[model samples]
Target: MKNKPQYAIESVDHALHLATLLQQEGPLRVSEAADRLGVSRSTAHRLLSMLVYRDFAEQGGDRRYQAGPVLRAAGTSGAPVALLRRVALPHMQQLVARVRETANLMVRVDASVRFVASVESDQVLRVGDRVGRVLPAHLASGGKALLAALPPHELAELYPDPEAAGVNLPKLRRELGLVRKRGFAINDQLTETGLTALGMVIPEPDGRPFAALSIAMPAVRFDRDLLSTWVSALSTAVTATDRDLAAAPVLGQSRGS
Candidate 1:
């Protein structure tokens, strides 16, 4: 008797599920992937092998799998920053034009702030920072704006070691209090000597902050009145940018999609 050939294979739903798992609880082992996906170890291995071959994921030294640079590049091609650049560039440019100070968009990652986009001010004493730079979240205006938005319990979780150098919970709480009261935060020579910055948070529709918009200038350039004006301008820019992002079809759908 002739035996029939088996041709069953995994579906796209399985692949998408595996991809989502890798995206969420990343750096998975074959056993871990199998358990999460409810598949056999060999099947998980085969799926991961295909994903690696396609550059969807990479295996690390510890034999765990994580999303590869290809996936990262693809995901960030139209990232929030990119969307912001398209939707909020004019507002950022306008802020820079009016204030003649460097305007930047930043997002918090762990205990640091990552500059996602920037537009340099047209002033002679410009600060000249760019995107992808990480700064201590405790020091920068944008960092404070982000930190001020986090829930107190989450903030405590983020800064667990109070005895560690540069970790001052009391000071941070005080700064955050001021930030919440004033609707903006300030960095006076905290990031770089002689530089000052003012920042405001860009809240989502639910009023949760996902990013910060800031303007950096020379400390000497801003007096108390000028600082107040800059803060107002920064707040305006953030509000306009938030509205623009809210109205953007691509960003609105992409976030939920």
Candidate 2:
């Protein structure tokens, strides 16, 4: 051991340290935390429980711990969505650079999805910035990726009256089923007249997805032969953002922003 900082509360330090790890690494097991902090497994469990109670951390279905809503609220910005935009921007930029196509980050909003951040490609014919755009969740690649994660009942709730919503329930179900099978979504001129997009959900530690990352390009430039390559690059970008969400330091705050 190098040295223990003087005047630091050991338990609090441990908790903060664990939070940092989760923010940077995505999720952590008790054993992992214990090893990292040089503490007993029981001690790590207690520290994590404290974080969970305070909403700074959340326990996922996999029994791993990750950054929670409190961290989003405590981030150095306004709301959780704003913080999400900030957290996902760098990854989006990198994705755009790699694919030479505009990359978008979006979140589900009831029956629709809202674009929070977009990085435009340098190509002259690339899709333009889509930030602030909203489209039906079933119509856009990013939106569909998020919607596809919802339970069947939830989708039913959203489209109880398909005619009023101008959506075909059976078709949407088929599309979502395909997304589930493939672990991603594709939009072939469903949203924009001549655009194509491929999207994958960015999962939270608990397995719930709060956002999706997508590549939007002109339909003419879309190559079916390169679909696998595009999906691989897009998935890598989402993974990077997920890691950032885990590593962000957002603790000790009340809900004002």
Candidate 3:
């Protein structure tokens, strides 16, 4: 057999790592960020300078850094779900206060569910959640609720392997069936032990669901009936938000060519 030429393996570059770090934790100083990334201070400064030139980060007094307005605008401009978050945060806060539990808004990004916004509960034993955390779709109540509203074929395409740990199709289908019947999904320590969650999907005007709302509580504090009540409240809030989104002006229409 003829020998084939070997292709060179590409190494991970500093610029890529720096970009990832900035995306994960913005408003970070060069020295502090360098310490986290295990790179030299000079190297981190250089990377920050490049990011500043590119309008990704802005240097403030005391050498602190914050995400530039351009970055924030880019995140929300053309994305409908991002706009949804901007509009839904107030309602989510109200719901969280009413239910006395942590509230979260999630959307499906590729094969994972990303938290767009969250309000932690005031209780001492609450789940500490934050935005930008991606969780496995199969194991999360928000993910299952969102998946329940997707088209069956699309759902199948997204989860080809039924036995995969995070994207199990069969399990998702069964859970989604239950969600469809009950109008919400429940997570009993599926993401973390002693943390329970209830979630419901918000459907668009065309009846397509692209996002979900969830409430998390300490398992010791809430039982099945209380969880169901929280789920009902979440569903009502999601419905009202969806109506408002459908009525509001589209965000990206003015900026496009």
Index of the highest-lDDT prediction: 2
**RMSD (Cα, Å) of model 2:** 14.9
Q: Against the true structure, what is each candidate's TM-score? A: 0.68, 0.66, 0.68
Across residues 159-184, which tens digit of lDDT does each residue of candidate 2 receive?
A: 88999999999988998999989989
lDDT of candidates 1 onward, in order:
0.76, 0.80, 0.71
Worst 10 residues of 3 by lDDT: 1-10
7 Cα displacement, candidate 3 (Å): 46
Candidate 2 residue spans exceeding 4 A from truth: 1-79, 251-257
Answer with 1 or 2, whichever has the higher TM-score. Answer: 1
Off by over 4 Å in 3: 1-81, 164-168, 251-257
Model 3, C-alpha of 113: deviation from truth (Å):
0.3
- Return the clash pairs for model 3, or none: none
Candidate 1, residues 1-257: lDDT per residue as tens digits? 01112452445545655765564335789998888679899989988888889888889999999887665653222235546656777899899888888898877767777676678876666777556566888888988998898889988987889668377898899989899998889899987888888888888776566788998877788688687778888878988988888778977775455
lDDT of 3: 0.71
